[model samples]
Target: MMATGGRRRSSESDELELGSSGESEEEMEDSSEDDQENEAEIQRLEEQLSISAYDYNCHVDLIKLLRQEGELEKLRSARQKMSELFPLTEELWLDWLKDEIRMAEKASDRENVYELFEKAIKDYICPEIWLEYAQYSIGGIGQQGGIEKARGIFDRALTAVGLHMTKGVAIWEAFREFENAILGTLQPSAGSILTPEQQEMVNAQLDRIHKLFKRQLGVPLLDMETTYAEYEEWADEPDEFVTQVYKKAQQQMEKRKPYEENLLAADPPKLAEYQAYIDFEVKDGDPARIQIIFERALSENCLVPDLWARLTLYLDRQLKIKDLVVSAHERAVRNCPWIVGLWKRYLLALERHQAEHKIIIETFEKALNAGFIQATDYVELWQAFLDYLRRRVNFSQDSSQELEELRSAFSRGVDYLKQDIEQRFGESGDPSCTILQNWARIEARLCKNIQKARELWDRIMTKGNATYANMWLEYYNLERAHGDPQHCRKALHRAVQCTTDYPEHVCDMLLAFERLEGSLEDWDLAVEKTETRLNRVNQQRTKAAEKEALLTKQEEEKNVQRKKGRSEKKAAKRAQKQALPGDKRKADQEEWGAQIDQPNKKPRAGELEEAEEEDMSAECGLFGRENNTRILETPALQKQKAAAAARNKVLHDNSKDDLTVFVSNLSYSIANPEERLKEVFESFGHITDIRPVYSNRGLFRGYCYVEFQEEKAAADALRLDRQELEGRPMFVSPCVDKAKNPEFKVLLLESVMIILFF
Candidate 1:
């Protein structure tokens, strides 16, 4: 039965091995295809990069593909070349280091891995990289002095990033675990008596473990409570020092717990919360904490250019650590290559740090290759580069390489803006001709080459600037300062004729120039030209004024006629409304008979007024002359009678009758006063006319006359008196011509009182 079982087990093992081998073969085939595809993609990206060398995304893609293909030689070369051009990001460095480590088969092969580790650490102080470095060094611990080397690496790692509040715990724990493993190896056999040598080794190992725990417990790290508990369980005796360190670490942990909790609860790219936490860390002024917080923020907000910009600016301005500041700026530009501001700032930072001239030039070239968003951006960038070039030149030298380079850059800039920028944007980016002006100024002021300056000014003028008086004056000044008087006069002459925008100013400049230096003939000619131009300008102004006056007169006459017609219609409607009920019935009967006798005949104005008055007298019980006079003599009634008399005088003088209401207290800046008044008065009844008073200059005078179709409509509109319009209380009152009736003084005084009350 035993033999049978052995045979069966062997058969099953063979079957399992066969199945595993088949699966491995399939995976190899799949990986081979994937490698081929990745190689093809790498080739495509290389082709794209050849066409556009500054294609940052393509560079990243090509590097990723090469690393994935396990083409070790090519990958190394790619990474080296990219690092030279742009700083390698943390993830890329890790990938490169990991690939190198995996390929190391022998102990000797670890040399390259160590070198790569050094390069990776310098790029960014990533705690993970340090931990990986320390762990990888442990594999060679059996070699000569290997243990010491690994310990040294661990010590360096701790010193570099041991203060990291979050990830630092891992490194500390790894250090302790290595020591514990060493202790386990040093222990004597279990349940066996130990020699003096064995006991001494055991005691030494135990002391090392205790020391490691003591050191780790002094620093506050996340999950350090677990480390403290383990140390307590492992200790042979109760140690007061260990307890004190644990208490201190626990206090530190509690203080940092809120920030840690916030970071833990946040999702990826928690930029705002991270910034606040970083600010708190900065306020604490602990360099370790501040750096860790920044790294934490950057790990999540790596794509955020402004965060990178802020970090770099801080390093540049405050820290002033050349390596740190330069590395940060390089990374910022690499991540956000399209941002011209970042590239510009990078250039300035390099200059500020006194970086080599060649590096600065290469960086500027890269910036130009990094496409900007607008043509104006190109112009501004070119100007910045040109300014840098100009600063390198020594003006005292008659002709130097720097001066030549400066001149060449100026020429290239103008041509680039004209050809490249204009073609792309459909207009010249240098609309103000600033570059050419700068070139002209440099030629005249520094090089003392008036001829070259003249040529630059010629180009500037040809570019649609010749018509501007300011442009002409600029050229004239340049000539007067650098060239002979002949050129200055010529510039002024061209300006006088070509400057349409400010011809008078240009003419006056010409006359002044002539008076200063011109011959008598020149002065007389300038005067003649000035007189002719001024006369022509005056004639044009007079013609415009006359045409405007004619239009105004026509408009006023039309408005008067329209007002008269509207008043007549409104007055007729009011008279009909004010009629007594009996009078209205009688008038309807008369209208019915008239329609049959004289079909389309209308009542005369005088007859309508007489009928309306008779109806008013009968309704008010003032049919007798004596009673009417008595009622009119009352103080309150006198004011009403005076207002009525003034309104009647106005209506009669205008040959129409209507209850025209006056609206005051309107805003002086009110727009469309007629339409506004119509909007308000039309709600009561049909608005017959609106006449907003205006100054002679056509500005609103804060008042208007609004005529309504019926007396009831006018009375209803009075309810709107003292109502607000445009933040001012509007006064609506009957339009009474106070000038025609002396007794209207009382009503005018009452109107004044009402205005004052509001």
Candidate 2:
């Protein structure tokens, strides 16, 4: 059918050509066969294409087709193959590169991929690509690099990113390089030594590293001045700054050095360094840390005086009293006599340490021998001795022997400080007031005799200048302690008379007089003084209230007068308006209304003067106790003061030595007790026989028989019994021996006594 159609078409074309040209049959048939073969081959090729496609190759073709269709996912997958195979292909490579860049960014593997892109950028000179490469290099460090190498990498990175030169990104990259340099790029090799040139390289690298670090920190490196180098030359001097460097270098050695090596190294001002740490730690409120520091300090030579004082303070606060701590402080003071704090702390530590007083006295003696106890400390030591003696005085036992010894020591100590003592007493300077007054109080307390205290104070009052008024007041306390009411009163009165400059002291003395003697009259006098002050205040207040009342009353009268005048004016206006015509009356009414609505002006000068006078009068009437609550408050305070004085007097008079009895069990018996009683009686140096009184049948009675050598002996034994027996209270009256009667046997005596019940 194709040959026939082609022949017919050929005939038709030949006929059309006969109208224009000519054609042949064989050529038309040949053309027809060729067309049939082409159609069949096209069909076979289409079938082969469907049957022969490989998955990867088909994917590549599909990708190309999808790329032309703008399918990015397919294009990306195909680009991945090309990247794995022909990675340097500029078309496939750029596509692969861009896609890889995108993938690297999406996975946050940009830092890992940055090197590859950086190479690409250097080769291509693509500013946009280079910027992307630099952006991804933030916080990235070369793994196999030193500080110099790191600095070069940072400079290159900065130059690349500097094309954009945003401050925020530059800051981040600089910090990253700085941190990398400090932390180091690689682990250090053990026992590794470098050549001199390598060392020089290292030093140059370190300098660059330090400069970069400083730049990142915003601190100028040139300005640092190598504080250590400057002070190292002056290290032998004991100045604060040299000592500070010594301290810091020691710390660095400790922090960076291994423990074993640290132990083996030569001593490097370790004591001074630990002391610095101790001072710092103490200021930071770390007592235990300070303790560790102090321990280290003392371990490396003995601790310095200042360090010893702080260490003892730490121990004292912790309540750890050790012989070692005591020895440390004492040694500190001995080594440095000028360390006053150490001296004080040594004494204080002794006070806290529960050793005997004799031992403490020995400690002070040791301090004196060491030349650390100065004259001032000697005075303090005396006061401590006196206080110890006073506190030891008790009703339990007579501490008189100890007190006398203490007093002797105190006197010796004062004599030791005598030169300073005399100079101090003669100074009479205002600054010496507190010290002198304290000394006076100590003197009063230490005096065994009230008469001595009184005599000493009298001498102070007579020869010692008028500057010693406080000393006089302290002496008043001695009379109070004596429980002599009249003496207390006289002392207070004399103290008040001695000085008028001290009103508070006078008032205090007055108050004390009232309290000590139970003198309600003095209390009333004190109240009267307070009441006088209150009354003066009340009188002034009353005058003010009276003046205010008068002013208010005058203001009320003026208000009434104003209302009356307004009423008269309104009546006059009404009368005037009542006589006018309609329009004229309206006009008059408007005028009157305008006048009525007008605001009242301020009062005239005459009225103001009158108001002022009324105010003065009211305030005058308001003066005195009627206007002031302080008048009432003052009376209440007086009542309280009186009650307090009376109570204090009662308490003061009632205060006395407490009753104390030290009880010890003498003897206890249950069976064969009469023999034990005889033994007891014999031990007491007396002639006495004891017989057990009991009922018949060998049962014992609760009473016993006692016979003494004589009547005086019997009475003496009874007296001793009353004093020694526990809960065996007895009535010591003489009685006849009933067993001595005619019919009474010794064995029946118990029955007789039991039957008689006596």
Candidate 3:
């Protein structure tokens, strides 16, 4: 089959390439040999579709297989069914349209083909389809009014897509070529001048061409300079107004070029780039540019409901054009019918546009059958329709068709949720019974139908709502608003009997109500009712508490067993690491150090502080603990500090003790420790590095070394000493070798958490 019309369509070779995939002889032979297997696979897809009609990939597969087997009728049926369920993508629509156009060319009845184009265009704003439609119209130019019809299509095509910057130039060029072709037909023999009457017809035709150029130039389309060049070549001196229009369009294009460049560089589904472009256009306050960019974005990202929403929202709030707003909303639902919010807005937009009752109902029915992913979407859509119906009814009057319609809709919607939605999703999505609540309110307040309202409330409570205090409050509030005091009192008695989650609150509300609207006898009766209920509830709570205590004891025993198991498993892992071969890198042994599995515990029995302080300096990087006892016992930390000591010996870039500040006493749980220190200390001077010390198990040790460019920067940073951070005062002191400067330390307080470092 040949793909024809505009350049956007595939060439004959490209179509053949596309068609060859379906016509592979080896594939056909395989299908022939495994006919039963192919049939079984097709059956599986069909069964899946029956189970879930919104299985999009299943439909595409079925269509492809049917087409491969030359089952044209079945393929057509499959594609039609899919299009009815959801909007077909551009590629799918293009292939379907090409096939239909091929059939239409062979047959005489082209009206079906025309109707197909209309349906295809409604799916999305595609310049390719509009261009094809206009080009297809040119085939019948010899018929009466056929030329006029073709020109009308060209005009509509320009209107729909002329604002598209990237590919819009193609449509403009196509339209101009069409006019030039017609202009050629009107010209006389070579070098011939016409009479006044014929010349007038010629001038009118020339003026039409001039207007097309003028209109095309006014839009800020890509490659618009070429169109200007064409006009300059056509008319020796272009009109001053047209030139100015061209200049303004170029200025707008220049302003939009960077955004377009971003879109070009971005991959398909350029949602982020398009969003940025849209925000810029919106800020630029050009509705035309905003709409064009949004359309371009949605072309690849139609599945995203948010993009559709932003476009429709802008149309609704800013554009304020009924046709555009309604069309955008309808397209939104068509592309994403599963989205409840889009359908909700579609309904509201229809009502805002005063769409006829029949169309609104039809759209609502379509929404109900759209195969929403969750049951809640169906309920919300129903609520929106019910709101529409309720508003239409004239509640002031006794009765009307509008009132009956609203009542009928409410009944059907309630049944749909209670039965259909429940069966589908295993629960009515409306757990609050919001639709029933709304209906009850309408019955009691609007029509003064107290008995009907009571019936609705009774239905509401029976659906597991009787145990909720809010449900009882809703019913009591309704009765107080419309019914008498007896109903309200009766409602409270039923609530106290049935409400479970918060029966005490209902009882209190009952007492308060009696104080306001009941007699002394009623008040006494309410008090007795409350006391009896509270006594029973308290007894039930005591038993529950005893049961919970037993569960707690069992849980504690399980936790103790789990902790023992984890400790044994960790012990085994440490033993295995210690058995590693000598060939293992030293870093491995350093990482999994001896005593790495142990925590530094406090002094036990008769450990003398004086003896621990004397042993602290015996090791290279041994440091004092809070009570001046040697604490850091990990071999990995000792090795690491020895490396730091070697680094200090080199005197690299003058990064010695004077240029470094020891940051300590911060909370161990401080997040992003080094970065936070940089933020706090970099103001003094350029920071070289921030080394936040961590425990062997990768926990922050509540200390780090901050190295600066100069000694004065370190001195300046000392102003932050004892400054509180993360609920602890920081200790900023010079980074010194504790063995060399034992007396430089002011004091080691036993009461304070002390960390001595090198």
Which number leads on TM-score?
Answer: 3
Candidates ranked by TM-score: 3, 1, 2
TM-score of 1: 0.57
User: For each predicted model, how many residue pairs clash, with residues at least 3 apart or on different chains?
Assistant: 0, 22, 0
- Model 2 residue-pair collision total: 22
**TM-scores, in order shown?**
0.57, 0.30, 0.68
Off by over 4 Å in 2: 1-276, 279-292, 295-304, 319-321, 351-359, 369-375, 388-395, 419-449, 459-469, 503-508, 511-758
Q: In candidate 2, what residue range of length 10 has the lowest lDDT sum?
A: 653-662
Candidate 1 clashing pairs?
none
Each model's C-alpha lDDT?
A: 0.77, 0.47, 0.81
Compose the digit string of candidate 3's lDDT tens values, residues 539-636: 99999999999999999999999778768866864664565455233434453353265445434333333224322333322223233323444434
* Candidate 1 structure quality by residue, lDDT tens digits, 1-758: 12321111226666568667675767757865986787688888878977877555677878777666555676777777777656577788888888788778976679989988987776567898999999998998998998889889999888878878888988988988888888888776879887899899889878887888898888888888888888878885749988898899789778878888888886545676788888887787876667677877876776688887777777776788877678778877876777877887788788888899999989888888777767887878887888888888899988999999999989988998899888988988788799999899999999999999999999998899988989999988899888998898888888877776788998999998998999999999888877777777778889999999999999999999978886896788687768897786576567446556765554465444443443345336523433232221222233345445434443222322246777887888887888888877898888877776655333567787787778778877887877799888898876556564454588678777766665
